[model samples]
Target: MRGLLLKLLFSLMLCLFILGTVLTAFVWYVFNYSDDRPRSSSHPIRKNPEADPSGVCKECRENTIDKMVEIHSHTWKKQEANFKKFRSQLTSRCHGATKAIVTQVNTPLESKIVYDGEKRKPLVVTPKLFSTFLKEQPFKNVTWETCAVVGNGGILLNSSCGEEIDSAHFVFRCNLPPLDKGYEKDVGNNTDLVTANPSILLEKFEGLMEHRRPFVESLSSYRDSMLLLPAFSYGHNTPVSLRALYTLQDFNSPVQPIFLNPEYLQSLARFWRAQGLRAMRLSTGLIVASLALELCTNVHIYGFWPFAQHPHDRRPLTNHYYDNRQSKKTVHAMPAEFAHLLRLHGQGVLRVHLGQCASGPR
Candidate 1:
């Protein structure tokens, strides 16, 4: 009986080992070798000249490249002209109001501050210095006003939006995730600023330095146009990855760092509180810092909804993006704030483009 039991135990262990090995291999294959083709055969393939011009035959490829270049150059010139006009309009309307608003919002907060362990200091520009920075060198000739904000929706795949997104005077991307593999066709190579809060940097980079190489390689494709934004407070987010990113200047594509003044944040918070809308004040610091980039002109926003919407329907969620999926009862939605954004867009305060979705969340 004892001999029989020992044999059975050995057989069970062998089976378990085989199962684990097979599962590991399957995961590795999925992550490393999966193709970008649609999972279902029912989905039809759309012909995109930029993605695959072979449909037109190989001989005309040179013509296609030349046409793309010519189109980009013309669009760039037109965008510059529009940006200058937009800046003039903005200055005429809001130049005085903005300063008064900033002063009114200014409040002192007794909060401790911390920085990532990286050696570079934050790039905090005073109003005058920021304006000067925008006016100098490369920007003197290049106009960077009105911008179109693009999101990473799969809907944008083969949607003929690459040129439209690129036409923006300044384009913004958050989290700086790679556009390689599955996303290359969606997010083309024309990103201007890579935005992040310190928390995002810390979470993605700390203790995961091995991941940095691929991220850096993807970003190197846009070396000349990387803009980094700092978090407002340690309390909002205190991620170790932020420090890791700061230390990664050795990566081929180093980002130009920009810091937000804590005072600006405190002031914004005070203003929101005075309005009796303290709950909506959490991200005010980020908003104020972003607005200050009016010096850069033609600011457009993307992927900045307060909450994630349905993956297919693009409806807003009541809970946060990272919330547990199993807990259905606890989830709640916030449409009022989204309505406010629409109102602001209508007032020309900011341009907010919704991703293509047939319905919004109820």
Candidate 2:
């Protein structure tokens, strides 16, 4: 009986192997002979040119290299010499490092906003209400040796700047960026202060009308950082910004929401306008950079390139480090902002990280 069972098992294994080999041979024959067609030498395959989502054609993209104007590796040493020198040019008197611009008394209510030209006379923040957000009040000691302002520009892709960025005494990232999903190496994991646009609240959280856990969970990555918002900048921004503040407060989140003093933003705009930058409004990155100039002794900016092309290889890049969403050119004069930042970089006021960050010479 044992010998008979062994013979039957051996026969089954051989049958299975023959069947697999036959199926493999049949599939190979079908794939190879299925699409036989006579090739015409004169009618060879023609490939379409690559399309640019920015709507620029190949010719236009080719000429963009010639139109590149900002100071770069090719031009920084040569062009910085031509620009006039200044001693730490600053605009606002209300940076955290020097003085607390918005304590209980100095909140600017009557100052006109940058975009709407309306006075913020109605906005108010009570001292009792503000003190409840953070019990520790860590910002009481405003002096920081070094700070990293991480902009969401696509130039940061492949920068490998996570370790360098996290090494700073404080790190500020604009618009809540996903630090997970393989992005931590390029964007870093630390967050001391993060500024949020009212539009982000509306678009991402549906104005926080329902299911608040996602919003609260997102704030967890920042740990005990401050959530800075331009609550009084625009008239429409007030409602949504307030909702965000409430969301954090209601959840007892570690992330504390801080409304930026409108007067500081106004002063910052006026200061940059005087510096020869032309735009409807300065970008958040520029605003953050301007504030960084005052808040820390050494400010290192990452991911701030404005052009679609990479600085080194000149390949096309997305509008943001996270996504390729099309940006409005008319809303903010991005090139002009980049030009000013480039000039500041030339002046040695702050360091801008253009390419990948390395252990040596960074």
Candidate 3:
């Protein structure tokens, strides 16, 4: 009877010990893992710098790269913590690293490229045109530590971001904007890749069918930068794209003209559409920024403001840093695209510089 009593007492003590262990674990989890507790230095509140209610763009004005990652909010803290996951979530659909441009490998001689603008019209890869394609993607098997996508917004007129922009491992520009002509200090002279719209060829150089010297001379400033053209985006873009390429070849210019793959573009459009971007077409700035997000470990976008007033000082601005010629609003949803970029900035996936840049290497 004494042995039975001792066994019962031992069993009761064991139950109490098990209950005590479970309670201790519950308390530990509440204190250590609960959101109410203070986050470590590694995780921060993912706040939108633009949406800061204080009227001061404190986070946006930071000159140092380390300071740029400080603005966060609770909603995006998880995304801010896992950049690789965010990048994969964004790029896995478009695959810009492998398929951003047309290559002989990606576009075989007989394959057809459906125009993104006119879905019914498709351009077959003829042997003559296939010869112009690079053997592989220029960005294939390459990743940059940092990248800069420079837009033409007039907010950059005197931002003095050149030194910082030039410091990036790779730089992307849109619409073949002039890099020289005293604009280098603000816009930078380094151009790893620049996009030229077909309309620019038709309007600026008379389709490159006449005064080819001026066209060739204008391209001299790019200095071996790969020129990307939307050759198959629309049916009308094909001739001018080809003309621009042929002109470069005829002059033996160092600037290499490449074609934007329509397939990749379509995929990108679908990706953006899934993200709630409904526009007639994605702007050049957004396209390059998205590409940068995929190719670079750290992506910084400059001059992306779509407003008429300065983001900081509320001063009037031009449509572009180089010229005030306004764009056709019906084509692109600028505000909507900027909203998406702003969200990405909030999530710590990328940094969007709306005001003047800090004058130095970043």
Give the TM-score of each candidate.
0.46, 0.72, 0.77
| Top candidate by TM-score | 3
What ranking emerges by lDDT with the best candidate at the front? 3, 2, 1
lDDT to native, each model:
0.44, 0.71, 0.83
Local accuracy of candidate 3 as per-residue lDDT tens digits, 191-240: 89999999999899999888888988987778999899999899999988
lDDT of 1 by residue, 1-362 (tens): 99999999999999999999999999998988676645676766766543675656333544533443333233111245544554455444434223212121231122223222222333243453332121212222344456545444333543344545566666656446455554444455576666555554555555334566755554575666645444434433423334334544566356554443444445444543443443433443234323433454545444334333343344444332223232122221222333343333444445444443222111
User: Of the candidates numbered 1 and 3, which has the greater lDDT value?
Assistant: 3
C-alpha RMSD for every candidate? 18.3, 18.9, 18.7
Superposed model 3: Cα runs more than 4 Å off: 1-82, 359-362
Error of 1 at 224 (Å): 2.7
> What clash pairs does model 1 have?
105-267, 145-298, 146-298, 201-241, 202-241, 202-242, 315-361, 318-332, 318-333
**Count of residue pairs whose backbone atoms collide, per candidate:** 9, 1, 6
Return whichever of 1 and 3 wins on TM-score.
3
Where model 2 places Cα greater than 4 Å from the true spot, the runs are: 1-70, 74-88, 91-102, 108-117, 124-141, 360-362
**Model 2 TM-score relative to the real fold:** 0.72
After superposition, the stretches of candidate 1 with alpha carbons farther than 4 Å from their true spots are 1-143, 150-160, 182-185, 207-215, 229-232, 235-246, 270-293, 296-299, 304-337, 355-362
